[model samples]
Target: MLETIGINPAELAASETLLKLLISTALLITVVVVVRALSARYIRRNVASMELRRRWLVHSRNGLLLFMLLGLIIIWGEELRTLALSVVAIAVAFVVATKELILCVTGSILKAGAGSFNIGDRIQVKDFRGDVIDQSLLATTILEVGPGKLTHQRTGRMIVIPNALFVAEPVINESYTHDYVLHVFTIPFKRTANWQAAQQALLASANEHCASYLAEAKRYLKRLNEYRGLDAPSVEPRITLQMPSAEEVHLVVRIPVLTDRRSSIEQSILSEVFSQQEFSGAKEKALEQEGSAPTG
Candidate 1:
């Protein structure tokens, strides 16, 4: 009859496969529905507790669904295998053609899986440091945070970074503490200047500026450590001396500050330290001497 209608052998085989799959699927669905209904009725009648009845009904429905799924897979196994091979070939070619897009998506998956950072969290990838403002599958948008890290000031520009960079580089999460963070900044002094006095002044300024929230930051860090099973670092203001060159001494200061107030707090500390008579005395003397000198 198919031959009379001009259907070739290959077309006949394909039509038979489709018909068989459809009929088998319908029969499986019908069987599953009957079994589910019967089992639910039996469970309700035989089970004493409501919870047990619910559990049994759920298990029965799930088992029936699984059975139907298995039956369908068996019925269409050969066709599915052929389709899967074609899909694999297409996918390989597509990946090769769009390798960067694939990498960006893969990076997004890695980021989501790792719980790396979220909107409003400050993150640094290579030289790009900013607060994450938006995230998409292919890229992340951030408000650029610095001319350099030490400035801790926004450049008032938005940067869209490809998500693929996350896979290739490390992401530094600066706001891991959420509310507050141990912020570090450096104050460099001339080796010939009153280095000891400058150190004292800087330490005093930090202590004064951070005194209000110092205890609170310590407690917050303690709780975080306890929650994460980590050893807590000291939150008290610290100034460590480092001599990077013969002409300079860097007084590295670390203190706790609200995540959003890092730049302000740093500015306050620097202003307070620099305004002191001890630090400004040399400049004042130089200015007075210049003024007394004959006019050019």
Candidate 2:
């Protein structure tokens, strides 16, 4: 029949093989599309966190890939096993020669498994600090902050660091245990100013901003002490007067607010302190007293 149609038998076999490959590719693509759509509709949307959604998507994708690999084995013939093993061996050798790359991949796996940090967690590794915007098999991306910008505010740059950094570098996950960070700042006033009044004003302002988180902060400290036997640090708004010199007195205020809003919250408290009528009124009264008193 092939001779009559002027088609060679070898050519016909090759064509058949190509057709099978194409069909298998198309089938795999279709399966992926359908699965992704279903997962996005029913699985991803209901997930509470971005990191959880990403995990679900990755699991679905890997499952689809495994299914496709099995399907390809049947489509490509049994003999492809030798070719697959050869390819795998070559890949292993290549990865072995590139030690750093393998370490990065291993780090990614370990970091994800350990759950030390996740996407959307603010972390500092070495000198780089940012929110983890992406974590992949080889790298983790950070939305850059600090070093010429506000410590907690985004600098509008992305820093992609090799995941291998996680293997060796100490990582500070600010939001790992809690969303609020202890924000501390100091304001100095002239010694003659009403430092007591200013300290009261600072406490009031900080408490107004941080009262909501006080309960949880206290509870966390309690549990922390129970678990680790570490002394529980004060988590409430507190003011300490620091006198570096007789001429200058500083009021140090420590308050807890959402980590991302540390700078803004600090600014708010300071603004409130300076704007406090009682604080300002005290200063005015002091000035009047000085003006009326006999000159030294």
Candidate 3:
């Protein structure tokens, strides 16, 4: 009859295999259901504590379901292998077509296994910086953090970054400490400006504004260091001078500030430095000198 319908031997064999698989699956499910029911009844009768009885029933049901799954897999293994072998070329093509999707899923798995970052973490991946707002298997959504890293201001934009990038790039967590962090920012000045005075002004401003939490930051860092087995970095405000070009000076200021208040604290320090008499006077003098200098 199969031959009359144009079904070849291979097709007939596959049909038989499928039918057997279905029957076996149904039988396995039925047995699992019976066993689970019996186990639950036994547990209810034998177990005195309600919690323990509930636990036993849950565990038994799970075990039975797992057993049924394994049984189905075993019963269908041969048929599945044959189908896979026949579709080797198709499978290869499918995989090639969905390579990026596969990579995204793999990257998600890697992120989960590594526990790299979580929602609300301020993370930087390659050129992207944002506060993580949502995470899915394929991508992460962030509330954009900056037009530049130093700004510490949200751009009011949402960015979706593919999880695959997490596999390819390192993620920097700016809020790793979750409370306070040592923030660094640069202030550029002309070489002719009173760099010493500017440095003093910046340092004084940093110290004054950051004084309330300096000790706390220090203690927190020390505790973190002990917990993580790392050397504790200083929480004290410090200024390092750098010459980036022939006529420019960069005063790098490092200070400990609360993570959420980074921008406000930085702005306060800048305001105080710019408002200082000595620093402003020096800046004016430098500008006058530049205006008076000979030019071609």
TM-score of 2: 0.63
CA error at residue 53 for candidate 1, angstroms: 42
Which of the numbered candidates is closest to the native, going by highest TM-score? 3
lDDT of 2 by residue, 60-101 (tens): 665676676777767776557757676997878887899898
Model 3: per-residue Cα lDDT over 1-296, one tens digit each = 76788879898787887787789888888888888888888999999976456556655765676687689779988877878988999999999999999999889889879988766779999889998876766888899989987789999999999999988899899988877888999988887667788898788888899888899999998998899899999789999989999988899999999988989999999888887655434766778889999999
RMSD to the native, candidate 2? 6.3
Mind giving the per-residue lDDT tens digits that candidate 1 earns over 1-296?
76888879997788888998899889988988998898889999989976456556655765686688799899889988988887997878888999998899889889878989877789999999998877777888899998987778889999999999999899999998988899998877777666677788788988999899889998999999899999999998989999999988888999999998999999988888777646535555667789999986
Model 3: what TM-score? 0.69
**Higher TM-score: candidate 1 or 3?**
3
lDDT of predicted model 3? 0.84
Which consecutive 10 residues in model 2 have the weakest lDDT in total? 273-282
**Candidate 3 ranges beyond 4 A from true positions:** 1-82, 278-296
What is every candidate's alpha-carbon RMSD to the true fold? 11.8, 6.3, 10.2
